[model samples]
Target: MTIGEAYLRIAEDRFRRVKGLGDGTFRQLSERDFYERTSQHGNSIAIIVQHLSGNMVSRWTDVMTSDGEKSFRNRDQEFEPADLPMDLILEQWEKGWETLFNALRNLTEEDLLKTIYIRSEGHMVLEAIERQMAHYAYHVGQIVYLGKEIKGGRWESLSIPKGSSDQYAEEMKRIHGKNGG
Candidate 1:
């Protein structure tokens, strides 16, 4: 594959991996856990998901033509407590991801070099992708951390379980051979 094509694939895979982490955490949380706050000023998973969905919609819609920060997006409101139903929250989350994936799927290798505006500032399409990837990963990490804290002893490992590196490696080697390729 061409460099641009490879980059696009890698970017999509990375984003999917981040999303999967959040999904696993979500499966283990109760509906009430979505709205729980560890501190007075802390954001709940609900708020974080709302903010992410809002961001994804704003940034990915008409990405090549319009500024990422849309006029209608109330970023501040995304942080406020909404006490929304779980289904609605999940719907928003899915909508945001679908918007992002659609944008990525439509992009061409040549488009990666073109400029896109976020707010009033200019960023190359590739730069914008990287920026969003990092931002999303950060928030996903927060969600996972909070889920773990709330679940405490009941939490399951999203990745390799603690103190099992050797076992994990052996299993991988068995599946993928000694070189793991």
Candidate 2:
């Protein structure tokens, strides 16, 4: 019911969105394919997962009490291409997010204003959560886009399909009704 709780909900929703992307489409690609760099500027899915895990672990552990960036976080290594297997990537993803959500689940509404540190700088608890949500969303967008490119026309739209905005709006209006506004 608090803003942090709302963030947890969004995290859960988007985490599922990230995982769902790999469900069917990933199986079509071999390790070599999954590891394949789709663009000169972008990392493969494996590296993105590594970064996500690193960020989650660093930012969530002892979040309200300690610097979010831990002493052991190897920040530089996150960007390096990793020969990580799909199973390992999936494991890290699961573990990282689990730790984050578990921590969030334990937070009280009063705790929202408590300060946390990241990179030795101060952040309000809600601010840090919002920051990471934005970061996760940025990467999820990349993942979806890259996944679609890799799958070509065989890929499904991760969101509303082309030219279907009106249909979606109409359905929402019918269900919720204009007077509900």
Candidate 3:
């Protein structure tokens, strides 16, 4: 297809991968694990979720016109631990992704060439998407790493298990070939 179409496809694919990693990790965690930090100053899963939700809401709400860093967002507060239930935190996580995905779905090819503001700095729409996508990927990596650490040997592999790369490659080839890829 067109360049914009390709860009959108790639962006959506990466976003889905990041979401899957975080969600899969979240499933492996217990309630206490959500609040457990790797260190005294490190972030817990709950805090990471809070920060992500806050960022998603701020950046995606009125994304086409308004500055991405919303005036009402208390970014600092996202780092502070709250006593909210795990379900509530996960609800917020879903809301954030909904907002972000909705915004992405609404984008037109031309919109990618247009400008948007984040923290008063102008960025092309595609650039803005790339920025946020990378940011979320980074945090998702953190969340997955923390989950793996906490679960230790019990953590279910999200992708190939530790020594299964050769088998995974063969399986991928078989599956893709069967689908005419």
Candidate 4:
């Protein structure tokens, strides 16, 4: 594959991994868990989902032609308490990811080099993609952390269990011909 193709593949894989972490966390959470906050100053998973969905729709829609921070997006409102149903909250989360994936699907290698505007500042398409990836990963980490806190000892491991690194490595080596990381 070409460099651009490789980059896109890796980027997509990384984004999927991040999303999978959130997905796994969600499976272990109750509907009320979505609304729970670690502290009064912290955001709930619901609010994070809302913010992410709003950001994805705004940034990915008309990605190349329009500024990422769309005029229609209410950044402040996304942080407010989302008293919506679990289904609706999940729908918004899926919608955001779908928007992002759709936009990524439509991109070409050449487009990576082209400049895009985010809040009126110029960023190459590749830079913009990385920026969003980091941003989403940050929020997903919060979701996972909160989920773990809520579930405590009952929380299932999204990755290998804490004390199983050696076993995991052996398993990986067995599967990947002893060359696995």
Candidate 5:
């Protein structure tokens, strides 16, 4: 693959993994737990997801041609608590990801070098992608941490389980050998 294509491939994989972490974490929480904050001033998963969805839609739609911060986006309102159903929240989450993936899928190699605007600031397309990837990853980490805190002893490992480094290493070695051959 070309460098640009390789970057997109890696980016798409990371985005998929991040979404999987979120889906797994959310599955462990009760509907009411989605709105529960770790602290009085902290944001709930609901608010975080809302902000993510709003950001994804704003940044990805017409990504190459228009400003990433859409005129219709009410970014400030995303922080406020809402009583929306859990299903709606999840739907919005999926919708945002879909928008992002669609935009990424349509990007040509040349598009990576193109300038994009976010709130009147110009950024290379690659830089914009990295910026959103980092932003989403940060929030997804928060979601996973809160879910683990709430689940406590009942929490499951999203990656390699604790105290299993040897087993994981062996598995990776085996897989690597197969691919190498």
Candidate 6:
């Protein structure tokens, strides 16, 4: 994969993987469950998702020609809790990812080195991507951490459960070895 494609792949994987953990075992939490402990300094997963989506839409659309931070984006409002259902929160999550995928889908190899600006500073497309990947990862980490903490014992493991890593790896290799050679 091209560097851009690789970055996009990693970003998509990390985002979805984190979200999946919440959707299954931790789905019992309400909007209040998500927002209750977070202070003003921290945002809820919904806000983080909204902000991520907004950033993706701004950065990826007209990427080379425009600022990554949109002129019309209400960055602050993203932090304010909306009295919407958890379903709406999921919609925002999906829409944010869709916006990102839509933008990433249009990229070409030539676009990698193209110049883009964010907050009036110039960044190569790859640099912008690295920046965004890091940003999303920071938030995804937050999402997963919060879900795990909130669910406590009820939370299911996202990777191999507890002590099964070796077995999981061996199983994967065994399953693939016969098909390949």
| lDDT leader | 1
What is the Cα-based lDDT of residue 19 in candidate 4?
A: 93
Top TM-score hit:
1
- The residue pairs in collision within model 2 are none
TM-score of 4: 0.98
What TM-score quantifies how close candidate 5 is to the native fold?
Answer: 0.96
Which one wins by TM-score: 3 or 4? Answer: 4
- Supply every candidate's count of residue pairs whose N, Cα or C atoms clash at under 3 angstroms: 0, 0, 0, 0, 0, 0
> Model 3: per-residue lDDT, tens digit, 88-156?
999989999999999988888889999999999999999999999999999999999999999999999
Per-residue error for 100 in candidate 1, Å, reads 0.4
Candidate 3 or 5, higher TM-score? Answer: 5
lDDT of 2 by residue, 62-165 (tens): 88888988998997798889867788887887888888878877876677787888988888877877788788878766766767777787776766788999
Determine which window of 10 residues in candidate 6 has minimal summed lDDT: 17-26
Evaluate model 4: give its lDDT.
0.94
Compared with the true structure, all predictions reach lDDT values of 0.96, 0.77, 0.93, 0.94, 0.94, 0.70
* Model 2: ten consecutive residues of lowest lDDT: 21-30
Indicate whether candidate 1 or candidate 3 has the larger lDDT.
Answer: 1
Please give, for residues 70-135, the per-residue lDDT of candidate 5 as tens digits: 999999999999689999999989999999999999998899989999999999999999999999
Native-to-model Cα distance after best TM-score fit, residue 19 in candidate 5, in Å: 1.1
Off by over 4 Å in 3: 178-180
